[model samples]
Target chain A: MSATLEKGVNAFREVMDAPIASFFNSCVHCGLCADACLFHTETGDPKYTPIYKLEPLKKIWKQEYTLLGKLASMVGLSQPVTDAELEEWSPLVYDSCTLCGRCTVMCPVGNDITYMVRKMREGMAASGHAPAGVIEATRKTIEQGSPMGILPKTFLAQVRDQSEETGIEIPVDQAGADYLVIMSSMEIMGYPEFLGSLARIFKQAGVSWTVSSEAFEATNSGIQIGVSDIARQIVMRIVDAAEKLGVKYVISPECGHAYTALRWDGPNLIGRPYKFGVVHVLELLDQLHKAGRLKTEGKTDEPLTLHDPCQIVRRGGVVAEPRNLLNMVASDFREMEDCGSYNWCCGGGGGVSANHRAEELRFKSFQVKKRQIEGTGVGLMVTACANCRNVLEEGLEHYHMDTKMIGITELVAEYLKEDKPA
Target chain B: MSHMDLLIWARGTGLQLALGVFVAGMVLRFFEIYSLGRKPDLSTPRPGKAWAGWKTIVSRSFPHPSMAKRTYPTVVLGYIFHIGFFVALLFFAPHIRLFRETAGFGWPALPTPLVDAMALAAIIGLLMTLGYRLYHPVKRFLSNFDDYLAWTLTLLPLLTGYMAFHHLLLPYTLMLAVHILSVELLLVFLPFTKLVHVGTIFVSRWYNGDMLGHKGARL
Candidate 1:
């Protein structure tokens, strides 16, 4: 083989040899993942097909990773792809994909395209091929500990500012709180209403929850940036805080990927089952609703729709709670056509919203959401995910679609006692 | 032509064509695999995801009463098509004869009429599956050329193969090659495309079963 061919061959091996690369070895390419994918629907491009998305992974598995894959890969059963050839895969893998885990929901083979997308991004990034914004954000995350490069002291200062503005105490290293609630950094930087609604709900629920300014942010950009150990490092903030604080349960906020990390994969990342209970906001709301603790008020009588965040609704099996909570609140609640676990992605997930180059494609790629929401004329859209909230609110904003965005907590919070402008 | 000569020739033609396609097509698949580019993912652990293949089929997939609660009920419907399709594949008599001579294997075939009925049932399943892909919004969104191609890949082999075997639509011998070709195409496609689910579904169901059961959640 020529040097370039050798480089191409080496690239194939580097990808094909890893265990994560071997994970595709487990996928039998059943199209059960089709319904969960967005690009397959949005562009009608077969190459953007979810199962087809795994084709590169599959070939790697068949070629160099598995006993069978290695045999197949070595004997020219599979082709060696050049860096340029693989570069063409960047948009299909990054911009066009949300890694929302919708496809992971229905995979009869349980192949997680989200994880696969993350892995592929890692490879792309290693080759210096990631999207520009992602590369910048990743550098900031690695060097500055947050993607925004907000100093930890600055983060602490933001908490102080929030407490001043809202008169709600966001705690740090409080010794004996019963709950160590973790939230995404976006709550501090952008969407403090999530924090406000959460504080309101937590207050009503009568739980002793504290947010650690030291290790408070729950949304680990590293998780989406294709750095698992770094992702694990970022997620360790909450667990470490919970252990130190002796909090009873760690409440993960309404951010989808954050919830996925804190609630589902938290224990695994921590290298043991969690000592503290991890409760998703939806689950918390569900419990409150079941207990009749949540008194929902001001459910608009106009047509309303519920968008299930991929984390809570699909992978987390939290289909009914928020809707049930919404129905309990909103008098005229209506459902988007394919709501619940079978829903399409909101075109912004797995860090796609942060990838500036992919932003334009994000709205166009949200064809599934658009079609589902088009005929409904829903004035209000409710969801449990903060990122879903941010993305869809922005999606509607970009499209100039007439829809208002609110979280389940927004409704649940309304039923709570407001300490008037103290 | 003597019955044995006709049998040998028919058998030889089918067997040789199948082996050649299976071999040559398999090599092609491997070439594609080697040429394809992918990336490393060593950070995450691959779960052992153990399950007894036979047992999980009954609990998780076949009588998947709870799977209806899943996002894709077509998957349950899929199991029916797969089971019935395989029953026809393994038990059809003419297929038994061809494999016995060429591949050095033989299994008892169902009675001729019973096999014919099973074939019809398989065709009906193919139709039901096709109808679902066409009508359901989620399904419609998920499909591509490959998805439609899969439907045809599933339906055509059963339709033409049945006709070839039963003397229903065309003469038995001529359609047999095409039937065999479709089966061969399926074999090649199976390891390559979404059709690979034939192999992965059982293991995945097992993996899913183990994972869900561990979580005290449903598959």
Candidate 2:
């Protein structure tokens, strides 16, 4: 009856479907996913192979779903997945994996290893084997409205501060606005300038946008912790607020998984389409740029390269928009190798940043990004995700590199053109 | 049974048994998978081209440029064995004559020497594939009993056929009968082993490509 081994087994059976069945059936055991993973590449450990991490899930599929497996288990030929096995796999599933989709992309038979990892995490979390740090973050998100424990008053306080600093009235609870903007807790706490920049740019563009006090946080810790029920509740808050305000769009902040949870997984989690469209902030800026509404006065002449966030560009389909926005305000923008849909992950994504146990492994995996940025030989790196920026900043500092990380919105805001009197 | 009787059983009764199990097992497995069905995606898609799913099935046949260098050996050897097997199976004169006799139709086949050369190259390619699996640490670790079993099943028919053609180590009738029996063994195991990938690869690649394609991400 407890949320232990039985619950984990039941959850796997519930999640098993056509795609999962076929993926397991079709795997050729080529081990190509190992080379596709950063953890395996950097650590040279075979256990970190992306497909190998799904052994528990695969065993469940075989034992309960396949004919031969059923017969074998009836006679006790196959060992049942025990609590100890789940315990052993905890580090492999959470600590060593970032769900980066690199292996999914590179799989010869197209197994979508990252998708399976996300599903496997459901079993891990249900079995009480989830990392302690992620459990705390999910608890905070459910109770405090933000994974970092930022409450409504704290979010409003940051709103007030941004309004005072920008000398513009930042709208709150404004019904029937053109856009309802949501900020990640990372942005609210680490980079309040992102909100200030959005306010300034919206004021100049004459776009109607407001932040809802009820649902301003965009990041979903339920997704990070791999629980759909909690993720559904978190997404429901935004859906309710946006529908009540009758907004035209909900702008996802420059947080990678936040955008994914809202724009991609949100509707599916809720089991219906939202009245308001969900758009990434960069996509909105790119749309305004295309409409001739966004005007910039100057561009940075320093040679800079973009660090494509894994979820935003690769997983979120915001690939072209970032480049389109960066081209507008950066005069010397350069492309990094393997940029756009095939970019390496920041290694702190998919709840790894929230799990304190994964810190050392996260740092080890960041070596790939380090080598990528060092290859560009640029002192300035522009990224669209606040989480990617923070992770990149930590990695850069850890390696004693002085590459400055800036959000694309903040970069655009610095070059915003002033409104002229007609 | 006498040796001649054994050859007769393998050619007639054994072939029927193997073919029946292979077809029936494959259909049942395919049905089990397809019957699970996909859940509807309620999320709205970004504005882009539709049918990215169908496009992905074709596109994934070639490796993405970024991944090609790292996966060159597997891709190369995979193409070699697959193409070689097809050419040796479908285009050899003897196989065509068998088809013409049984199925009442046949296409023109390659010259006997050309088919012989292709079979030799394919056998070498499969050996190299096995060698790569043994030598590479990652592949060696990932390999299981099922993988080796599938490899042996696939390699046996080709090896025995080549031996019968060259008349190596045994009389022609004995080698030919062994080749037929080896092929029947492969037919029986095809649906049950990792060799099922031959049918499931397209299904998996299509599903993956379509899912990502709907999101407008390049495969």
Candidate 3:
């Protein structure tokens, strides 16, 4: 079946639990969350306030769960959450909100407004109110192996090209490798240099890793679209590939939500612990650096800044690893005002980048990030997430700014110390 | 009823009923929230950040440093309001006596003038809060009947308590009764409205902090 309002309402009921109940109950309409959200702050639009985006979900919670709400419904004192409301809220739920979690941390009552937005998307997606672009992306993710509809052949071709370019054999489906490396479609299509960078770094570190033909796509449109089952299908591919190959760890590429989906949410989505571990590329690189296996010749002389991907640093908890690795490669790295876990979003996360309708608002909200970059006065900006890199590049280009961008992995690879221990 | 009878009722049956509803309603609301229960996080948690949940419960009381300028009315004024309200509620001589009689123990009360100042500060903070709510676009847009109702119920107790203490609004017996009645109104509605946050905020903080902290993100 496609979708129905009943299904949407049922999905809302299914997702509702203690944390959400507490969050909804604890909200005092202080509106401080708006200040924490770039969408509201940049646009000065009250509708973009974080918690208000969940009005439909909150209504369902109130109508179905609360005693007063039940009585109100019975007496017709309160209107039920209608299909039209969900339809109207599509842009707010999917387009404007980026699941950045800035509002989650800033809520005075600790409401976790971003958490509710993630949950609210479940209803929105099930109700068929998800934006066309996102729905298409999810469809492509399920039908093809990737959201961008890049096939395994295309991925292997890119791997082969990178292998030739780097003079390193990019292993595919190699059994008994120490790590099963994954890549998001953005890195595959937009920045295939990442594969070359990873190959060089892993080779230098003496790491045995392979790209799985079945699970090379790291970004999960299912998670972006808020469907657990689809997310599970996407994650299970990696788990299966890892288990089949007996890889000890799975490397999440420089994609923000991809790391979160694999590291934190994968087991829960699949309802079982993975046989192998999940590590972000930065975490693995930092480990190699600390172990003295990974070394860089010299730091970049230019003053540069790092943009912390919300999912990778804040939500994924790979906070120190980026800084640890960046310290080795960047000499004059300046910190943003709220860098590391409290960093502002690139306005392109949580399927907003995938949604065509969100482009205008997304660009408008990029003002906060632009100010952050300008404040640092850094000509070069480094980030670990490919999605952030893409979004930040778009923002910079749209504003006609000349700030150069690089992935931390690629930046580190440029300075890789090639000589082996004698 | 005469003012004396009203005062007697407010102290005796009215206080008892309010206290009863407050306790029972809170218990029920807490059940409504906690009983829903969350799923266990099947993801491997990062070690060494176990206390982050409790830490955030206390830490979240302060505004994020970068956001402090923008959140002055909510955070700074919010602190003033909460501190003043709590001092008046918990430390005033009559309140302490009442607590001692009911709970079998009481701390030494604050100086009357200090408690009075705090209450005055809280009243001012609350008025400022009202002004902020009206003026701030986001808050104004988000505010509903329940928000304003909770605000009124909260302010009435503080306003009426101050009036009763000063014997300014009405005859002393009538004002005290009204004060007690205002508090009783707050008590009865506390569990149903956003005022329930007084209890649920801790739960919210814990859930948020624990989830993030489990992933090794300090909230």
Best by DockQ: 3
TM-scores for all predictions: 0.74, 0.97, 0.99
On DockQ, who's better, 1 or 3? 3
Better of 1 and 2 by DockQ: 2
lDDT of 3 by residue, A250-340 (tens): 9999999998899988999999999999888999999999899998998888999999999998888889998988889888989988898
How far off is residue B204 in model 1, in Å?
2.7
**Candidate 2 Cα errors over 4 Å, as ranges:** B1-5, B47-50
Local distance difference test, candidate 2: 0.88
Error of 1 at A109 (Å): 5.6
TM-score of chain A of 2: 0.98
Best by lDDT: 3
Better model by TM-score, 2 or 3?
Answer: 3
> Comparing to the true complex, what docking class would candidate 2 get?
medium
Better of 1 and 3 by lDDT: 3
Ten-residue region with minimum lDDT total, candidate 1 chain A: A17-26
Native contacts recovered by model 3: 0.89
* DockQ for the candidates, in order: 0.16, 0.74, 0.88
Q: Alpha-carbon interface RMSD of model 3?
A: 0.8
Best by TM-score: 3
Q: Is the docking of candidate 3 incorrect, acceptable, medium or high quality?
A: high
- Could you give candidate 2's per-residue lDDT for residues B1-219 as a string of tens digits? 666777788878988898898899889778868888888888887555376656666777777777777778888888889888889999989889977987899999999898899899899999999999998888898899999999999999999999989999788878888998999999888877888888888788888876786677777
